[model samples]
Target chain A: MKKLTTPLKVEDLKDLKAGDNVTITGYIYTARDAAHKRLVELLEEGKELPIDLEGAIIYYVGPTPAREGEPIGSAGPTTSYRMDSYTPQLLDQGLLGMIGKGKRSQEVKDKIVEKGAVYFAAIGGAAALIKKAIKSAEIVAYEDLGAEAIRKIYVEDFPVTVVNDAHGNDLYQSGRKEYLQWLKEN
Target chain B: MRQIDAGLITESVKKMVMEANYFLPEDVYSTIKEAQDKEEWQLASDILDKILQNADIAKNDQVPMCQDTGMAVVFVEMGQEVSIVNGYIEDAINQGIREGYEEGYLRKSVVGDPLNRVNTKDNTPGIIHYSIVPGDKLKITVAPKGFGSENMSRLKMLKPAEGLEGVKDFVLETVELAGPNPCPPIVVGVGIGGTMEKAAFLAKKSLMRSFDSYNENPFYADLEKELLEKINELGIGPQGFGGKTTALRVFIEYYPTHIAGLPVAVNIQCHAARHKEVVL
Candidate 1:
């Protein structure tokens, strides 16, 4: 398993491979459909973004309501593909990593290769399980958006698997192909 | 007719919300465990492990299973002989949802306007369906419908002559087209019959039944088994990584329909499958 820390760099993304387990630490940023829209709007306006994109990892999520005595509610990853349209734009601005469930679009994969970015797949539907990695979390911006608001999360050993590598390797494609072929033969 | 207090209905709903959102129903938990044991792929097994862990954390910590805690959805069965006092049953359910969501610190996922995209803020005004049955008690079940799987759900209106093969093909294609997106190893709910909307409603409602539960009709049960086998054959696997356990279960609910049309709705559910029930 790989350990990730904050202030991530392009070189930090180089060695990662599809299917490799990873434990991510440091300050991860949050985004979902609404947040993605706002981020794109900010980019279009040539304005500073809510968070820096350089060597940063964005988590696609919107958490549940927090009960008493908790930092956040079941905060599992949303599907990554929903943010496909806005990803390349952010990757162009130096976004190096993303964490969510499932696959990315071809265009997103191409950009990941060209920009040396990586996509990590977190366990979908495993919100509470994944949230345990988040030792501390606070809304950093966009509070009015509720769960979609951007939050800066301090994680410890946040487990994930590399789904799309900088080299454009996609596990979803390879993995599905392997099983489907086996199904046909048997 | 008997009178029932609105406050009681509200309390029942609140319990339903908390229980459904925070806990994994025992049947679902066991079903996942069974699937994990049966899953041959290491990656899929590990994913299933993490899902079990997620349910643990959500239950023990009183956290929601997913951050999207989903739009509050409830199915209610009321006895015709019984009557609610001081308020309409629908409004009481809305009130319960509001309180449960607020009290639980669950995300308010509902929006007031689809076009303007404004959040209702309290998660009130749940999508509630009620059926009047013979009994004195009101039975309700709450299922938090997440956007990921809900987005992938499909409804098709085919000519009656299309037959069973058409139904099976459509379902397989829906999941195939969904690919990795709906967080696979999904539970597919098939609603066949009635009008288009009824088919969709039954599909969602069928999901409320136990994952391991078989259709009462033997023929339908056989179809369920066959469908499950075929879906696993697709190799969509866990989270769409290749594997044998593409689906944990298939539940089909059908009603007699007009001779002209056969409507089938496929409602896909991720592994979370969080649901809870209360009767009073």
Candidate 2:
């Protein structure tokens, strides 16, 4: 598996391709549907974003409350498509990576290519296992949103797969085709 | 006739919700393992392993299997001969869910209003379905319904002329459109016949049944097998990573409907298929 650290550069993501298993360390900002809307609203109002996005990676998640003595609860990736409408704007803001599960819209994929960003798929329903990689988490903004609030999370060796890459490789397409071909031949 | 306290109902719901969210039932666990063994793709295998590992962690840690522990869906079979003393029965169920979510640290996912978009905060007002049945016993089952797959669910009002093949096709279409989104190796709940809403209810209810459970009618049972095979062949696989196992099971529940209407609803449940029961 490839390893990457946060505040990722264009060069860091440009070489990544779909289907590569990656271990990403460093900070990934957590934002789901509500936080995305608020972030864009800040931009519209000519205000500073809650967190700097320059070469930043964002993870789409809404975690359960942190139980006593734990950094966080089952903190798995939520479906990513809900952020599509607000995505290109985030990409434009120098966002370099997105960690979540599921297919990206064609529009978002195009922007990922344009922005030299990568979309990584974490295992859905594997929250507890995923939480093992998260070392710390704290709400960064939009606290009223509860679980959906923005949080800055520190991760170590967080597992993800490249679903869409800078060079326009899509694992969901090629992986399925390759698997079907293997199924047919074997 | 025997009577039970509404507080007892509340207690049952609390236990059911906690246990169900914390543990992956054996059927789901084993099915995932079996699929992992047969998976041809390396990624699919790895994903399944992680899922199994997550379940283990949740069980051992007493934490939820998924972060979106989901909105509590309580299915009640209340005896007609018994009455719930002290508070209303619905209130009791909601209270149970309130305490369960609060104490367990399961995320309170319910929103107060769809448009206004306020978090209900305590996960109150569970989606409850109640049926009046024969004796003094009350059976409560809590299935935490995550919106990831619930949002992918669909209902179609097919004409009688469309027949059985149409029902199968609609379900397949829904799964295909859902693609990798519902976190596959999904459990497909197919509700056939009845009016529109009843069909939808049955679709959701079918999800609570055991994965190994089959329709008593031989024809429907065979159809279930056939549908499962076809879905697996789609290569959507686990988490839509593509493999030979797209679905773990397909369940169908039917009710008599008006001659003019042939409604079918497909309720998709993710691999997290969590549920538990308490009989009081």
Clashing pairs in 2: none
Question: Which docking category, incorrect, acceptable, medium or high, applies to candidate 1?
Answer: medium
Against the true structure, candidate 1 reaches a TM-score of 0.96
**Clashing residue pairs in candidate 1 (N, C-alpha, C atoms within 3 angstroms):** A64-B67, A65-B105, A65-B106, A65-B107, A66-B105
Which segments of model 2 are wrong by more than 4 Å? none
Tens digits of per-residue lDDT for model 1, B31-108: 889989988777888888878888888788777887877787899898988989999888898999999888877888
Which residue ranges in model 1 land beyond 4 Å of their true spot?
A67-69, A180-186
lDDT of 2 by residue, A1-186 (tens): 789998899999888989888999998899999999999998989999989999999999999898788888888889999999999999999998999988899999999999989999988888888888999999889999989989999999998989999999888888888889899998
RMSD over all Cα atoms, model 2 = 0.9
Which is the leading candidate under lDDT?
A: 2
lDDT of 2 by residue, B25-116 (tens): 99999999998898868878878888899999999988889988998988999888888899899999999999999988899898899999
Given the true complex, what DockQ would model 2 score?
0.85
